[model samples]
Target: MASALCCRARSVSSPILSSARIRRRLPLVGAFCVISLGLSNLCPSLSFKTGCAQSLPFVPLFKSKFSSQSQAKSSGSIRMASESNTVPSIVVYVTVPNKEEGKKLAESLVREKLAACVNRVPGIESVYQWQGEVQTDAEELLIIKTRESLLEALKEHVKANHPYDVPEVIALPITGGSTAYLEWLKNSTRD
Candidate 1:
């Protein structure tokens, strides 16, 4: 029975993953989703239902509708194994002026519990367009890992502290990560 259920989940998961919407957001989300639905999408004949199974690693596929992380968190939008006690799974990469600024920003985020850790990678060369001309500058990058719940506050912290006219505040999702590490990430950043 357990093996059959795994097979069922794999079948439903394959197509649901091939869906048009999920591809763009983050394939990591798709990966977590595969674990969650556990072949539930294979049965389209079943009536559409409400609620989520993110806690069970076998939820209905239709519930994976929203593209934004906020929406996902609100509705049990993502799933993991029963053993999963992972914290949050979002990593935001930001560019700042210098090591001094980077460290300051990192310190602030940690102080506020907005991010677990903000690693300052210095001496990065960035090339981009500004005011109609292409430009290159040596910039420091702040790699911050935190829960999705803390992203908004993190952004606010960055905006207030960063010295750039428009700092790079792009974030990427962590789909399949160390279960223990994820739990640490959540615990470290909690306010």
Candidate 2:
């Protein structure tokens, strides 16, 4: 059965199975060869030459998908998270002393292309310890959306511009959201 599949695979010469397509599908072919033929060893090479699988040790099909180094060595045939076309987005939480400060920071961030959108929530009460005493104060919250890669720059900008000595700059990864909004967020922020 494995030999028949291999023979059929080898005999396939359609225009649809061009070199680029073959390279893109090599992992699937390698997986089929390993599972169907019970082959313990196969080549890591992406070539489709006859008898190539039997000549070398098996290469895990999913390795390159998870490892950047492996993906780099594989000539980028497989796409990883870092190599994705869409930029990874993040949500940042920053608390400001008042609405005036919040607006100031939000405007600056958007104007500088560090943040896509900055939603200001007013009249929030924060209770925290400061200078060996518990303090309570009303604060404004700035919810910022931007690219994950811009986190450090955003944080630095906040630290430099924010009124607080230690400004609240908390970041959270955006797992999923509207595709259009995410794309807009990606486009709004710097690379």
What does the lDDT come to for candidate 2?
Answer: 0.77
Clashing pairs in 2: 42-56, 42-57, 42-58
lDDT of 1 at 30: 57
Q: In candidate 1, residue 4 scores what lDDT?
A: 52
Worst 10 residues of 1 by lDDT: 41-50
Runs of candidate 2 exceeding 4 Å displacement = 1-85
Q: Model 2 residue 49 lDDT? A: 42
lDDT of 1 by residue, 75-180 (tens): 3423541247775468999998788888888898888889888888989999999999999999998899998877788788888888887888998887755666
Estimate the lDDT of model 1.
Answer: 0.71
Give candidate 2's error at residue 90 in angstroms.
0.6
Model 2 over residues 17-124: C-alpha lDDT tens digits? 555565567678667766543322222344344465455454444233335554464554322333545588889999999989999999999999999999999999
Task: Kindly report which residue stretches of model 1 are placed more than 4 angstroms away from their true locations once superposed.
Answer: 1-83
| RMSD vs true structure, all candidates | 15.8, 15.6
